[model samples]
Target chain A: MRSSLILCTATRFLLPIILMFSFFILLRGHNEPGGGFIGGLVAASAFALYAISHGVTYAQQLLKVNPINLIASGLIIALSSGLFAVFNGSNFMQGYWSEFKFPVIGKIGTPLIFDIGVYFLVLGIALLIIFSLAEEEEEIQ
Target chain B: MNLIVLPVILPLLFAVIMLFAWKYISLQRILNLVGSLILLIVSVLLFTTVLSDGVQSLHLGNWKAPFGIVFAADILSSVMVLISSIIAFTTALYSFSTIDNERESFGYYPLLNTLIMGINGAFLTGDVFNLYVWFEVMLISSFVLLVLGGTRNQLEGGIKYFTLNLISSAFFLAAVGLLYGLTGTLNMADLSEKIKLAGDNGLITVISIFFLISFGIKSAVFPLYFWLPSSYHTPPSPVSAIFAGLLTKVGVYSLIRMFTLVFTVNSEFLTNIILIVAVFTMVTGVFGAASQNEIRKILSFHIISQIGYMIMGLGLYSVLGIAGAVFYLIHHIIVKTNLFFIGGLIQKLQGTYELKKLGGLYKVYPIIGLLFLIPALSLAGIPPLSGFWAKFLIVKAGLELQEILVVVISLFVSLLTLFSMTKIWNEVFWKPAPKDNPEISFKHFTLSKKIMIFSPIVFLAILTVIIGFSVEEVFQIANQSANELLNPINYINKVLGRF
Candidate 1:
């Protein structure tokens, strides 16, 4: 879908802010309502909007890495987070937290890591399917 | 971290690793082989642990029983896992020769491992909702595996398979919702106690029917089995083989577990209905096989028929009956998968699955003919084979129950099963090759490929013969498992940690 010049410019301006907000959602997911699934979906919508205003090829170039790779890596991260508990002599998926606080993201834990993994997974899979469909449409045209 | 959860965890971890290693085909194959071997070892250990220590339960995320998701391994669950791992290992070996580089590179290993994980989870899960989740996991992976080749026939079959399964899943979910509403619990052990307390209600009977229909569609019994024959013959041979071996059996297992464990109020009406369905499923399956000339399609119909025997055992609702069902289940999975592997081999040699277009295997490949005979005769309930023992127990149970008519129909179905098996034999092996392509042989294939093809079939065939010869020991275990199913007190107590 080719948008008007104003709409395209507006999408470009809104993309960064939307992406940042999605990250915020992912970070606050453990204590708040917003989580990895919703955050990833929101992030994916920003890229989808960019693809609509510009072209799929431009969006592809922006992605830098294949979506399949992102998905695989995301799953690996999530699975490893679960395994980390086993290494610590606990059950699978047992969560552990640290008191150390980062500058922006406060106390870190395995659950948060798992949420981040889910964030990448949902974003990668959604973009992968959508971009492929868009590319197919372009080919038909 | 518990031993009981390893069967589910190991395969899942392998699948994730396989996803990343998808680019390197040979490496993926090696990893799959090693991973399946590990799964086999783990499941065998689980079997031994359950044998010695009774039921093993793990509450995931460290939560207590009724509220938390529980993974429990009883004798029945462990036995199923053991058989599943064996099939997974053998199929992984067979896939090396049969699966092409194209399919292998497309994350076939990952999907296969994921499917195994799902099967293991389904067997071990103590929570009904968790069982549904595992079924979805199994279903999605199986869907991809079914349509992996992207052939037109496969896509058509995949759609049919997916649609029917989705409807069944909907039924299952609704039943779960209703059951939860009634009893306020999803744990199988807890539900067992609560359902008895809430008992004798018509609504419970309705819920039982809902579960029957849901699991019935899954197991492909009688009238609800059209999607099975239509779709099962469409996937690649190894894919179909695994589907033949394990998928419907999972449905049967769930049926057995739910009926025997949770819905313990057995009315005469329900028993009669189940008996009728069992007999019809047998007759229709065999008759359907009799009409088909294509090898896999014929075998596919037979899968439905054999499911009847298992259900008959359940309907009998006796110690011998459940044991018979358990034995039939173990024997059938190995035999059915071996038959599909042989079919794939025949297809490789003759370039067709249609019996009329293929022949002369007895003369050119006598060894292959013998291998085929083992599973074929065994499937037909010939004496001293595994099927004979399975059929004998069920028939004996029927007679003991005084259901002579059902027994008569079952015996007739056995005869028809023999007829179909003989038809495949006479056409595919005894007859002369078609005039167009006279010489049908696997002579040109490399030695490793030949070994890869033959090893799984031989190993499984040997297992069948071993089970046949060691019937006493095997039956003892089956009897014990049956006793456990008949009396769920031990299973419930262990899962709830009441002991």
Candidate 2:
């Protein structure tokens, strides 16, 4: 309950960056250890940590948006990413590839987009649950 | 292609829309309505698709073999999802004015949507570990919803509900770990295939027991019925109704699916153990309901008793039996929710759930009184009501198996159920009016509350009527659903790489 603003704001900015990092974990999860589920969970942990330090209201305000829309957008993004795979004649959630050898960025695929969708979903649902429960915790007092 | 994934995705998308629009009641209403509409259409389409295609599987990320996550949907899963979405949509409509301002935090709208996600996910997931995860998603949301208003009673009940379920989750995880260790695959389809290859081994039996312990607690079957009565009575009627309608059914659905497809039913050892549990559960639950003084408490106890009937059918392991369980489950969700919603309305009118404190509401709210009878009689297995057909099929299953005792128990329980329902009628509606009291200022039927509460009853009552007359059709669908569950290869072939 004793979370600081610097920690909070730092996380407010830092969590997304960290979540973005987890996206790589999901993208390469098929070949290695990480994948969508775990990556999504990490993103959830980011929102949760921020919510704990900031009040639930602040967390919602921090998103500067309603949590539901955030979740919806994530779902659409995830679903459409899957749809993209389907369009490419792959199965739902099938990873698609479009790689270019840039100077720095190496091979990347459509799975990265799916991970972003998952990132928002995990964060949104997790936030939805926490905020809903936290609202009750406040009421009890 | 996996029909199961659609249920999870669609409402999830809508839940977001509802959450954003939560502050604007009209917009929230529209989002909830439109979202449910889309889900309903999708469910119907999926149901038709499954009927024609047998099963549809989608491997996530198109990765082949057991490495990638998979989703499978067969007839049973699709139909169940359809029913769940329909109930959810109707309940959302029913909640419009009834959700009380204090309880109507915008977040709740999303929570409802997520709750659907959990249920749909649980129903459609093709793997064991994933099912466990889906169960958690569904359940934790129920816990929050159960105690949403944070009334003192709700808190006490919610804590117990949460703790017991958390323990159940641990048991489920333990089961999953053991099964995964033995079978090396969490996908239900793959597990079904492998479990057959394993062929009635000792490890499988142990794992089955672990699953029984876990799902048993969740389904609120015998020995685990303690938590239901204690916790269920606390929440507002709508919350209680939804909990009654959806949550426990997930447990029952899982039990039937796993036992029939994966664990192998009636292994003599398994069936006999379940049969014994069924009898005791039936007796205890009926008696428990008979003795309860509170309306929701009685219904809660009745839920236990009703689950006994469902399990008895499953234990019989006959086609008719499993089909009966499916019908009973579908019937129970709608009927029980209707009854609870009515109970909530009664509380609104009389300001109490206590049977002793109430009387003569028939004069005050005749339509509601009539409304209560429809589901009550249906619940009690009266002839010409949907409840009768549920029991009839189960009894037919018992007769086919020549299990006379189970048949007799089912009959006696039906009578007792009727008696308990009548007691509520006698006390709450038929008896002479109590002296005008402070709690119920004698003013009844606000336009908004009437619509909010009556809609659930109207819809369910219509379903009761439809299902009653359409017994043959309902039974056919239920039978096919049961058949699909018993052989989940069709499901697995669709979700994972085709075998």
Instruction: Give per-residue CA lDDT, model 2, range B237-291, as digits (tens).
Output: 7778888888888898899889887887326788877877888888899999999
Question: Mind giving the per-residue lDDT tens digits that candidate 1 earns over B265-330?
Answer: 755767778888999999999999999999999999999999999999999989999999999999
The top-ranked prediction according to DockQ is: 1
Q: How would you class the docking of model 1? A: medium
| Residue-pair clashes per candidate | 0, 8
DockQ values of all predictions:
0.56, 0.45
Residue A17 of model 1: what lDDT? 93
**Fnat (0 to 1) per candidate:** 0.47, 0.69
Candidate 2 wrong stretches, greater than 4 Å: A1-76, A86-90, A117-141, B436-449, B487-499
TM-score of 1: 0.96
Weakest lDDT window of 10 consecutive positions for candidate 1 chain B: B264-273
